[model samples]
Target: MKLDFNLKLTQEQRLVMTQQMQLSVKMLQMSGFELQEYIGKEVEENPVLDAEYDTNSNLKEKNNEIDYKKFIEYLNFDNYSGKNYYRNEEETVSPFTFISNKKSLKDYLNEQIIEVNEGEYTKEICKYIVENLDNRGYLDNTVENICEEIEAKKDDVEYALKVVQSLEPDGIACGDLKECLKIQLNKKGIKDENLFGLIDDCLELLANNKLGEISKKLKIKKSEVQRYVDFIRTLEPKPARGFYTGENVKYIAPDAYIRKIDGEYHIIMNDDILPKLKISPLYKNIVSSENNDNDNDTADYVKKKINNAMFLIKSIQHRKSTIYRVLEQIIDLQRDYFDYGKEYLKPMTLKEISYRIDMHESTVSRAIRDKYIYTNKGIVKIKDLFTVGISSQAYGDDISTIKIKNKIKECIESEDKKKPLSDQKICDILKKEDMNISRRTVAKYREELGIKSSSKRKRF
Candidate 1:
């Protein structure tokens, strides 16, 4: 009944993202390493764009006919906030200088295999087993499955499995956690039958710290069971934990550094990680020359490239400025944390920082996304500074979720081993301290801290 199409002109306000604007947002969200790569790609693609890898290098005059001062003024490199953004007297070392080759786990095993006096057939099977081993160094396939897949005898496969397991990283190629623990214990010359029994049958009980159940099952005294369990706890759960598992480790490069000097904290932007952006003089001349109207194609091309280069440079500056402002505000807000330590870190939110800096909450989020900052203690993710507030009932103040998690960790750490504190008990303790949190919330925070339940944390 109302199927009429008509053109209506109504005025409304809406935010439309242009290409440059989208690029600005992307730049803001990029980590320090990511921004470096993005800028590198841009330098390769855009003829008008040039990048100086040396941060300490001064601007050299190129193409004598062009005005160097005017060109420098046009690029605004001198006034850019990203250049020597922090005026700290002490020189900071670059983290990238220490990058070296990392030996993978498989490579380490293969190297040890070369020294073994085994026949080629057995060695081939050993290699196959090594290849099949998961990142945790556990042999995923059974001997029967290996025999079926490789068309080898079960005996040969078992022998090969033994050979692979005997290599360095003592617990390698184990079928399960129990086998792994036994191999490590046997290698360490621990020949206690009770320990072997505990590994075989009481692993679940051991995990829950149920020494009494273990003692009852093994017909041993509770104190003796506790001693054995304590020794067994030192075993490596994952054999491949410290070795490279063929995955490239992505290193975090801090965008800025917060250091304490004299009596005040200072923010030092990491300008070395990024290459300095500059307009190529050749392209600049082409864009600046006025008498080239006859060749509209080349002029338009150069002008477009110049516009793109300028926009890219502007976006980078905006990204740096936004991140700097956000970090500056964080330094101000979390001054106590920097002055003292993590225990003094105040609860902060993106909305609070956004209001303080007169920017939208989303902008603040993007500004800190995938960004990291080096502090006096260590490198920390910028987002980690912003934690959701948990209201304190006693003083009517808010506590950071991070603080609650820390408190939970402390409670579990200092708890009596014989009678561990339950989640409800922890909640009650926190409540007594004026932190109003439910038992469920306590459990959630405990889990987030990678802690086990009270039953699992308990000892004999």
Candidate 2:
């Protein structure tokens, strides 16, 4: 075989994202509070970017044109009122940031330990027990192990265990789920032998609804076992459910609001709380200078910064406008929902809104990403406007999946506790209401709402 070397020339057109375009896309996805934080960093890095405060209503319900430059002085601090950073003076700390005075789980237990009026050695043992509690309010160490560690007798350790377990929250310092249930039961003065036996030896059977086995073994009626299980459902496994989670509480500010003016609905951007961004006159003057063209690097550096600043300003404007238009379209489509209640919420999708507004679906997605708007129904995320719908043989738009799920939750909440409604029964109930959905979908929606099935929901 003969081999020949040849080179072929081919050309193709392709679209590439530039640095400015990338920044614009990134800014488009940032929320209102996140944009403020990003702008703060940008002000520190770029000398050409300047900010000002706009003395207007942070929440405006009027229809007015958004003048981004109206912001002259940025008074963005909300939680730190007494702190002085703009002027040279003493730094006044905020009381909300003082975490030392707050009581932790261990601190709370120790206070109760001191009130016990027990012996010094016993109190010390209880203190050790309290300190050894895990974040879930469970004692990870056994009494025997604690006794060996402190060189104390087993009786003292057992007493300390009981003392620590007697603290509030009903189940603190408990070693396991069984002990936790017993402690909470003790607090409620519940001493049913059937309930105690269920916790100790038949928890698995109880969960699977084999109460017949429990009734036979414990010599208690099946109805009584069912009643005990129902009570157990009310107790929490993790006693410290709402303790300090070591995370700052995030505060959200809606980016836009829907207002009614003389029986008209309008979508307006929330630009008052945001810091106003504009190019510095000093750098602008330098960039527009024609005579000082001797140095290329300096001119290039200034021009690059100027272009970046302008693109950033334009990107922010685009973000606000895009969000405003999205809210406008959503309000148009789901008008009945906003005017009435969630029951009127229709089936909607990003594709539908994007097609109506002549925008790419991804663009619409980015515009509503982590964005919120204030309606008469209070503040709601823009993403919630896009919901899956279930079509039925009825008038009006398709019923939203959110509405269906909410209805399922209502059915379960109001159902007879002795014989809870099954998924098929719930489907029939919805059919009577003109809602056509399958039993599998009902079960799926039930699970999404954090609800168990009829068997698990059964009570006596």
Candidate 3:
């Protein structure tokens, strides 16, 4: 091969993303909560950015307008009663009033230990057992191991285990699932031998709904086994299911609301949770001063800050408009779903919506990511509205797979318990309703819905 050095002029067009463009893309994907946190951090870093809460409902509609001077004058925070940095001191409310006083699982158990009239040594052992419990309220450590670790006798450890297990949840400190079931059963005064036998040995069979096998092994009538199964299903599998685990309860705020005004649906953007951003006039004044021509450093610094602040403000407005347009298209397409119920939910896709809105598919995807909307139906994620389409022969329009799955669930629920509908039977029923789906796809959707097979769902 021969090598030759040559240079040729070529013209080509290419697309590149600037840092501000990347930030705008990222801001579009952030949820309402995440965007608030991001804005809070940006306010701390950028001197020209000033964020203040806008409490007036009348002023919320003006957030999309890019008139910074007019917005600053209209969005004064002097009389604002909402949560913000610049709220009146007299209007501030104490935060401690909202603090949760509920005791955690361990704290709850310790309190019972303290109240018991047991010896101090035994109480200390009880505390150790409580500390060793898993989140499921089952003891993770063996009695022998506890005895060795705390230098206590095996009998004392066993007694302490009993004392801890006897606490309010009824199955706390249990060693295993069988023991937990037995403890809950005993607390409930259920003394059926068949129930105990099923819990002790046939839990796997019971879970799989193998009542016939259980009946054959336990030598009980199938009807009796069904009764025992029904009673066992009422028991709690996890003793700590409802107890607090020292984590904060997070609440979701919808990004927008669809309200029916004057018999017409309208999209209302939720601007309350977000801080209204504005550029500091001080920095703008500094940049516009002619005397600062000699102070290149100060002028450049002020100009850079002002540019960043303006970009941030524009990016926020773009995010709001993009989300609003995306949702407006969604509400138009899924109007029946919002007006009626989930049954009217139609199949939709990002590609279809992007085409209608004249934006890229990726931009549409980012607009709906982690975003939720409040409707007359309830709060639902915008992404959840985009369901896979299944061609329907009856309507001539594509139907949502969610609706098919819902129909299948209804068929199974209404079917006879002694003769549960098989996957093929469910498919045939859906076919009768003009939903043409194969048995395999029906089975797959059923599994996704956490439904068992016909054989496993059958009752004696």
Candidate 4:
């Protein structure tokens, strides 16, 4: 082989985002409070910029009158579909989760394991073992490895593990998926050696639904293997399912206000949080005097500062105008959502909005992202207005994903716990309504809506 070198030329189109444009986009994306904090810093650092506080006089007490519980029940449609939710008159504040308070599986398991009346030293070793369990409650370290780590005997570790595995949820501590299921099944008085062998020996085969091969290997009937599979399915694979890594709530300050006044909806940009900005008269005088006296260097410096201050003010105004225009378009398009609720929200996209407003898609994205608008429903993120569309066969139009997800959630909510609806059945129901979609697509949408599979949702 020989080395060779050649020069090549190619032509391509590329879009370059400039610093000022990037700053403009950044300003567009920030919430009212966030923008205020950011601008405060800029005003302090720049000598030519100053602000006049207390700009908003139209602020009203109506912002405080939102029914928090009814709002929650509306948002959590999965739990409260067609169910009347009432707020407690005794409570004064919103019940939204503002902090992460849920106990992790590791911590929850450790608390129970330590109460087993085991020796203090040995329990300490057990604590180490519990700490090593992953989010799925599967032991990440082997018994031998944990024993070595804690400088304890292998028997002590094994006994500790047994104590933990005996706890609630039936399968708290295990080394693998097979062990977890077997432990739970054993607790149920299930003594099938073939079933245990199937879990330990061919777990992968079971997962892929290869019942014929397992039946032949265990010398059991195919239906018998399937029956065992169903039993195994009942056992929890993820012991830490309900307990999560915890979540916190976010507080939003809307940058725009939209509401109907005398049967006409009005859109107003929020100028309260952001201070009223202007160029400092003192700095402008300095620039003018320096230029008149022919002090070239000082004049240039002052002029440069004044120009920067002027540009920032203009950029900020431009960002506000663009956002207001975008919200106007959103209100015009998703008027149904405002008039009704989330269910009436029409399908839309940043690209579609960009085309309609004759702006770049990226600009439209930045203008709406992380920004909120105040309406009758309280504060909502502007980005939530844009949703992808699914085609409708009956109306020959595109239906919003929000609408489909809501329907799927409502269907699941109304389902009988003993006879849950399958994805295929859900698809058939949709088709009868002339909204044709595939079973797999239905399954995908169901998962997106956080609805579990029919088998998992079945009640005893």
Candidate 5:
């Protein structure tokens, strides 16, 4: 082995973190509500940065609204194809608003319990149980455990559980699945040991729609087992309806709205969420004009503050433009998805879009984080439209894993319950349909879709 001490020169590309990169990531992950909070914080912290709002000014005006149609018309047709001339319209413009009122899980539960008619002791026990309930509405402590903690009798805790269970939605205070079901079943006058035993023994089977196993175990007919299964299916798995109550829902406001107009889709970036920010002209002029020895330190300080303010303004502008560009790339790649919904969502990777948009994969990933798009269909998480692709048997055509999973769901739905399609059979069907998916893929897809295998799905 010869050791060469010769130096070799090579050129390599590297990514450096810039203010634009930092701002891009922040903008991507921030929802409208989060962005509002962030800007408010920034305005408070950055003395030079201030917000100017004109109540009469529309979002378009504040954004220096571009005439999309006129802009597109001015573009040379020879340089771009119909596909390249995509235009997106604004969907809706509304002021950024946030929910100032938020109740903790404990507070929400206590408020509901307060309305119920109960003795002081029972109320105290209920409060203890409510405090111990997990976010999923399951009681984190056993009745005995809670009784010991609160220095109350076990019977008193049990009575409190009964009161909580009897409250709206039937099963709120349960510690586990069995107790939750048992509470609901007891209320329905189903106390028979054999029937209850059937449920306990076959809940796994029952959940997968396997009534036949239950029937055979109980020495009853398939029809009898199905009757019980159907009854159980109606039971609420989530015991806390009140805790999860938000009927008239408000979702995150999208930073951009993509719309289809005259057979073309256009992109409109919503800058309304961002407060109007600029350096104070009066202060800037004063600082620039005062070239005196006595005001050196003051001038330097003012200049530094002004520079920081300008940087912040530029950061926000760059953030908006970067988000718009990233969204444009997403719209181009996921045109079918936006046009036709989830079924048409092609399998797309971050790298592919990043490459197309001349951005780093990580940049693209961050650019889409927690971002949303408001469209004719509704507000959809931008990231939801991009998924891993599953290749089809036919070369040049790839199917999204989501699509294959949906096909499997359809096959199962159309299958006779007595003879549900086996995983291998499902694969065969997909093959016949030219999807060319293997049995393993089919099984994986089935499981992902929460569809059980043939044996599990078989009814009596």
Candidate 6:
């Protein structure tokens, strides 16, 4: 063996960082709302930077004419105190306050439990249980385990568990599916031995809507089994009642709006959220007029401040134009998806769009990060349309992985429940439909769609 200590490099590439480069990337990832907050903070910190808002500024100055009307319509008119509007209409008006008032699942449950009849020890145990519940409202720890940890008697824990179960959110405080179902059934006054046995013994099959097997095992008719199943289906699976408080409602303010006008899709950037920023003419004249004075230090200081202000304004303009260009390209590429739906979304990659738009792949990726587009359909995240492609069998054409997953879902929905399709069978079915996917690919797509295997999906 030969050992060499000398090293040589043929060629190398390196990235150099600058203030502008760092700011560009940071600005790209921020949404419209986040960017507004960031700009406000920057203005407060940097004396050289200033932001001014004018309600009378024409929105059409930045956006195209067609989109200007649609954007204004979305804004909607509201009457102020001076306007001669009806008093009853005041209740329907929405203010610009963006604060959210929402309580989490556990917090809501705890509040209710505190008001219930229970001893001090039992209430403490119940509080512990509520704190340990999973997001889906299932108790993560067993009662026995909790009793052992707390050094409390099993009866005390059991009493607390019962009280917790009786709280408003139906199936909470239970450890597993069996306990959840038993609590729900007990609340509904269902005490039939056959119904309890069916639930405890064959809940797996029961959940799959397999009425026949449950009927034969319990010596009951299929109609009776279905009636119970119908009742069970009405029960809420997630017992965390406060989970859907709408606290984390994500309001999307799109960067652009694309509309169909005269058989052509017109793209317009939404600059309503963006305040028109420019160097104050009065301030600029002050600096320029004092440049020839004897005080060199003052002149230099003014020049530096004016330059910083100009740079800040220019950055805002560049950011807006870059976002607008990127949105236009996305609208052009996803024209079919906007007209139709997700099914028509063609497979697109960052590199493809980057090349088309004469920007780097990283730049394009940053441009679309957290950005949104308002279309005729609704507000859609700009990044949601891109997906990896899988090749088809005939003519070797490629289809999107998302499309293949949708097809798999459709096949499962329409498949006969008596004989659920296996992974290989699903692959064959997809092959016939021109999606040349393998069994592994089928399993991957199935798992991604949250569909279980044939055995798990079987209807008994």
Model 1 lDDT tens row, 263-313: 888887878789889888998788678878888799999889888989988
TM-score, per-candidate, Cα-based: 0.83, 0.81, 0.87, 0.62, 0.75, 0.71
Give the winner by TM-score: 1 or 5: 1
**Which one is best on TM-score?**
3
After superposition, the stretches of candidate 6 with alpha carbons farther than 4 Å from their true spots are 1-15, 53-93, 96-164, 173-178, 192-234, 242-248, 280-286, 289-305, 390-397
lDDT of 2 at 2: 100
What is the per-residue lDDT of model 6 for residues 240-279, given as tens digits with 9 covering 90 to 100?
7547544565556777777678988877777767665555
Better of 1 and 5 by lDDT: 1
Q: After superposition, how far is residue 296 of candidate 4 from its true place, in Å?
A: 8.8
Count clashing residue pairs per candidate: 0, 5, 0, 0, 6, 0
Model 3: lowest-lDDT 10 consecutive positions: 84-93
- lDDT by residue (tens digit), candidate 3, 1-460: 9999999999999989999999999999999999999999989999989898876444334556656554455444223323434532222243574796877789999999999989999999999999998999999998888888989999999998888988888889998999999999888887878788888889999988999999999999999999898988888889988898878866677888788778778998988879989888888888888899789999998889888888888988999999999988998899898888999999999999999999999999999999988776567889999998888778889989989999999999999999999999999999998998899999999999999999898988
C-alpha lDDT of residue 140 in model 6: 91
Candidate 2 structure quality by residue, lDDT tens digits, 88-206:
11112334667675567777778888898688888899889977888889998888888789898998789878877887878999989899989999999988776888899998887
Best by lDDT: 3
| lDDT (0 to 1) per candidate | 0.84, 0.80, 0.87, 0.77, 0.74, 0.76
Best-to-worst order by TM-score is 3, 1, 2, 5, 6, 4
The RMSD (Cα, Å) of candidate 6 is 7.4
**Model 5: lowest-lDDT 10 consecutive positions:** 88-97
lDDT of 2: 0.80
**Alpha-carbon RMSD, each predicted model:** 7.5, 7.7, 7.4, 8.2, 8.3, 7.4
Off by over 4 Å in 4: 1-18, 29-102, 167-170, 186-234, 244-316, 341-352, 370-460
- Runs of candidate 2 with Cα error greater than 4 angstroms are 1-5, 53-103, 118-132, 140-159, 187-190, 290-296, 410-416, 429-434
Query: What lDDT is reached at residue 334 by model 5?
Result: 81
lDDT of model number 3: 0.87
Compose the digit string of candidate 4's lDDT tens values, residues 151-265. 8888888888887788776787788887888888888898978878988887887766666778888898877887788878878998878875545534466687786879777
Give lDDT: candidate 3, residue 259.
82
Cα lDDT of candidate 1 equals 0.84
